[model samples]
Target: MAFEGGERGTTDERLTARLRTGVGERLGTSDEHDTLVGVLFCLPNLVAFSIFLLGPVLYAFYISFHEWNILANEGTWIGIQNYVAVLQPAPWANDWAPLTDPTANTFWYSLKTTVVYAIGTVPLQIYGGLAVALMLDKRVRGKKVYRAAFFMPMMLSGAASAVMWRWFLAADGIINSLLPSFLEHNWAGDPGTALMGVMLMAVWGGIGGNMIFFLAGLQNIPEELYEAARIDGATGWHRFRHVTWPNLGNTNFFVIVMAIISAFQVFGIALVFSQGGPYYATTTTVLLVYQRAFEEGAMGYGAAMAFLLFCLIFAFSYYQYKNRDQAEVGY
Candidate 1:
């Protein structure tokens, strides 16, 4: 019995040693070293993202529950009052009919304006971009120059573009100079035309980048498909409808989602041109947040509004992702 016990102990010790060897071989190899090196390389980006992006977001969320004022440099605990104020109808607005008081109802009015702005700009940007991309895809002389000209507006800083458009869209600016006398009016100074002016600038600024995406999509389509369509006597319109549009489903989806998000977050154009408007016509959520935070010194309120806008953008993106996935599956 003593001999047998000693033998069992020896076997157990050998097994333990083998297990340790296996673990060491797995964790202390060149692959492990490579992993370690990769982690070290990623550390700086992780740290930078945490410090510059995630940290600020978390801090803003924390401050959203407090009444924060930049001038005071201190915050008082408000316990979601800012959020409540942002969500609820304004005191001067009709509680049962908030839309009736655009001037006083801050959140709803801004949301409405944002939706309108998105509607006004996104489709035009997409269609205009697609049109330009299709034209550029053809064998044309000086194609590079045409592409550069179209893309020039996007290269300019948003502030610079805004400033330039402001000058051009002024009552007596270049646009008015060419228009008939009956059509001329204060483009940026009138509420009815202000949002349209902003939309025009947005469409012009965004088209070039969006066109690049479409051009890439166009290039990816197999040329043989077009040849087949031509052999079947398909017209240009039919070819675009059946061949091009079908192939560009993913690209179209991406452009639409991006355009919606960008339009929702529009600020610089409104800032330099309309300043939220002659009557808050071009006031986007971001513009409203800027006004609340910097212009009004209501940091907490601004943060709350920003969080809400983030939620909206997140929801839209998620919805689009789900729809796109389902669509791809169907296709």
Candidate 2:
């Protein structure tokens, strides 16, 4: 301590520095105490995330490194062997065939189907959602009720929705009943229509929630921004292009990512409706992983498939991040 400053003064300076930060000054009545309290409050959530999320992911990776069969209680240390089997899917042992075998399997076909489903579902969902949200954002009669009605499907349990749609898409269901009584026959039973039917069910169930999100984002946009654009002789399309659309970039990113992930991860619908199809056509990566782990009792293979899925999601998300910025600039 300097002689000019007593020990107490130095300690007070340290406390003041700790409490007063750039953005968290509002956290405390006085600057000094706020900082410490705010930091202490944040600690619990950080710790919980580490324990629950990060810990499990790390553990799963560790498990993937081993050859584990939960039912037989047999596993050996085989570094990367599971991953190899999962990707290769070549000819396997007597007990393992190409389709069922985790290793040396042609999972690429399933991956292709998943891509098709995602591509088919996402644009329809996003566009349909935006249309409803636009109408809801307007001054319509019973608008709140209409919004709630639209959002109801999202509140329905995913598995329950799948079951309900399974009946709806089957041969003798409502859709077929309305079909010219000729064309509407057995949609889900036919391989050609089965995958499309699943895609339609997913989009139908998912659109409303994204509509609410888009509506909120649209509503948050300043009315004056539109008014200003109008004053500058901007047409409706031009106004949206210059003002409303650019303002909604973040919400668009959020909706797109959520929709894409949901499309890619679809399993319950396939489980309830097609059951991997007329023949493995609708077997998504998630369903494949589930079967390998639980149904077929290939824990090692399942873990590897799960890892590959993680990689796919990570790649898609990264792609979106890259493209979203470009979209914003173009907007």
Task: TM-score each candidate.
Answer: 0.83, 0.82
Cα lDDT over the full model 1: 0.87
* lDDT of model number 2: 0.80
Q: Write the per-residue lDDT of candidate 2 for residues 179-220, one digit (tens) a residue.
A: 896587777788778888888888888889889889989988
lDDT of 1 by residue, 9-35 (tens): 799899998887787688875557767
Off-target runs (Cα >4 Å) in candidate 2 are 1-36, 72-74, 89-106, 326-331
- Candidate 1, residue 217: Cα displacement in angstroms equals 1.6
Worst ten-residue run, lDDT, model 1?
A: 322-331
Q: Which residues of candidate 1, in runs, are more than 4 Å off?
A: 1-41, 90-97, 325-331
What is the number of backbone collisions in each predicted candidate, taken in the order shown?
0, 6
